[model samples]
Target: MIYLDNAATTRTAPEVVEAMLPYFTEQYGNPSAIYSLGSAGKKAINEARRTIAAAIGAKPEEIYFTAGGTEADNWALKAAAECCAGKGRHIITTKIEHHAVLHACGYLEKNGYEVTYLDVDRDGILDPESLKEAIRPDTVLISVMFANNEIGTIQPIREIGAIARERGILFHTDAVQAFGQVPIDVEEMHIDMLSASAHKLNGPKGTGMLYIRSGLKIRSFIHGGAQEKGVRAGTENVPGIVGFAAAVRRALSRMEEKAGRERELRDYLIRRIEGEIPYCRLNGHREKRLPGNVNISFRFIEGESLLIMLDMRGVCASSGSACTSGSLDPSHVLLAIGLEHEEAHGSLRMTLSEENTQEELDEVVGHLAEIVQRLRDMSPLYEDFMKSRRDRT
Candidate 1:
């Protein structure tokens, strides 16, 4: 299959698997134990933490491991809320955030916290000025995504973080989609909290990390064993952590090279699809988008129908966020960008990876053009368009 949904998750690298195998078999020991084997496991986990911390320009002790991005997001938001409970009960975020953040915010609202959901522009970019205006005296935290998973639009994170810093409000970013694909320096960005998942970057699933600035005084979201420096508690997934670190190292080391190739391939696919297929419009920012993402909306055809056709042709893509793919509702991201419900239903997101080649992209473009045309031909919307054109003539 020609996999094109890297944004959902990536294939674990062979090197990462190799690095993790020993931890699973020979070094299988509880990191919390005081024995020799436990020391070995603890050493591996510490090294992995250091590696990930260095990659993102964070201190090792500031990193807390978790089950995945969802948990990390929950921890960051809830912890921030608890830390400033006496100070404020207001939070700020965009309308297009992943469900993890959105749902958490919803829960906070029900619990007496006031939330301000900022709207995005036509290109799916949140306005920094809007964020500034939305800040109230009770605003305690601001959470924005580093990059949109649906359309791949990079946000003005540095500016947003700077604003939050100037105001003494904590800044949190959901960097799950941008962690390995783009450069992230927590110190430079002034980010107080950040979340990332291993699986999105070709590491093992069920592994993620949250970066909390030192001395933030946030409450623990999990309680039990004193793992993750007492911030998160659970049995450590030593093998998964090992694999995550290996993947982070490889991704950072080869980021520039892989990013260049991804940009080329993504551009080629977008150009081919828009040029060859009629009534197709590209989504997201043209210049400030992700190197590997190409989201498009084809008029007169549904995204689910197109996805099934592409799957039959051995091409894998997605219509919306992986977490909400089963839901029939139009994507919140698309609606935030001003797409009508019907138009949003016609959207398809294609995310590339380093493993894809020009030949594979070309094949995908050809198959997509054929499938879209076939489906549109059978659509009543297309038939009505033809009738209108005949009347105009």
Candidate 2:
């Protein structure tokens, strides 16, 4: 199959698997134990933490390991809310955030916090000026994603972070999709907290990290032992952490090369599809999107139908996020970008990885164009839309 859903999750690299194998069997002792094996596991976790921290320009101690990006996001938003509660109970975020951020914010709203959900531009880019205007004296934190998972539009995080910093408010970004693909320096961006998942970067699943800037008084999400600087509890997922670090090292080593190739291929695919298919438009910014992201909306065809057709043709893509796969509702991100409900339902998001080949992408796009045409032929909505267009003319 030509897999193109890297934004949902990536295949764990062989090197990452090899790095994790020893930890699963040989060094299986808990990191909290005092035995030699435990010490070895502890050492591995520390080294992994240091590696990941250095990648993002953070100190090792400031990086806290979590189950995955969702957990990291939960911890960051909740902790920030609680920590800044005394100052103000208001938080700011974009409406296009991943469900992890949205749901966490919803929970906060139900409790006591007032959250301001900012709207993104037509291309799915958030406005820094809007964020500035939304900031009140009671605003404690601003959570904007680094890159949107559905549309792949990269936000102006540095500008937003600068705004938050100037106002003495904490800034957090959900970097699950942007972590390994882009260069991230927490200090340089003035980010107070950032969340990333390993699986999105060709690492093991169930492993992620939250970067909390030094001296941030945040509360713990999980409670038990003194793990993760006594902030995140439970024994570390030593093997997963080790594999995540290995993947980070590998992805960052060839970051430029891989990103360049993916961007070229993504553009090729987008050009091919738009050229071959009628009533199709690209979603996300033309140049500011993720290197491997290609989200497009077919005017009348259902995204689910197109996804199934692609799968049948040995291509793996997605309608939107895998997290919200079963939901029948149109994508919130698409709607936020001014798409009608029908347009949102007809969107397909294809995200590539370094492993995908240009030849495979070409084949997939060819198949996709044919599939979209086939589905449109069977869709009465397409007929009605064309009829209306002819009538208007």
* Tens-digit per-residue lDDT, 1-393, candidate 1: 999999999999999999999888899989899998888999999999999999889999989888999999998998799779899999999999999999999999998899999999988899999999999999999999999999999999999999999999999999999998899999999999999999999999999999999989988898987888786788899999999999999999999999999999989888888889888888888877889999999989999999999999999999979999999999999999999888899999999998999999889888988898899899999999989999999
lDDT of 2 at 344: 91
Q: Candidate 1 versus the native: TM-score?
A: 0.99
List ranges where model 1 is wrong by over 4 Å: none
Model 2, span 1-393: residue lDDT tens: 889899999999999999999999899999999999999999999999999999999999889999999999999999999988999999999999999999999999999999999999999999888888899989999999999999999999899889989999999999999998999999989999999999999999999999999889999899887988788889899999999999999989999999999998898888888888888889999999999999999888899998988888888899999999999999999999999999999999999887788799779878977888888889999889889989999
Clashes of each: 0, 0
In candidate 2, the residue pairs with backbone N, CA or C atoms under 3 Å apart (3 or more residues apart, or in different chains) clash, namely none
After superposition on all C-alphas, the RMSD of every candidate to the true structure, in Å, is: 0.8, 1.0
- Show where candidate 2 strays beyond 4 Å: 389-393
Candidate 2, residue 96: CA error in Å? 0.2
> lDDT of each structure?
0.93, 0.93
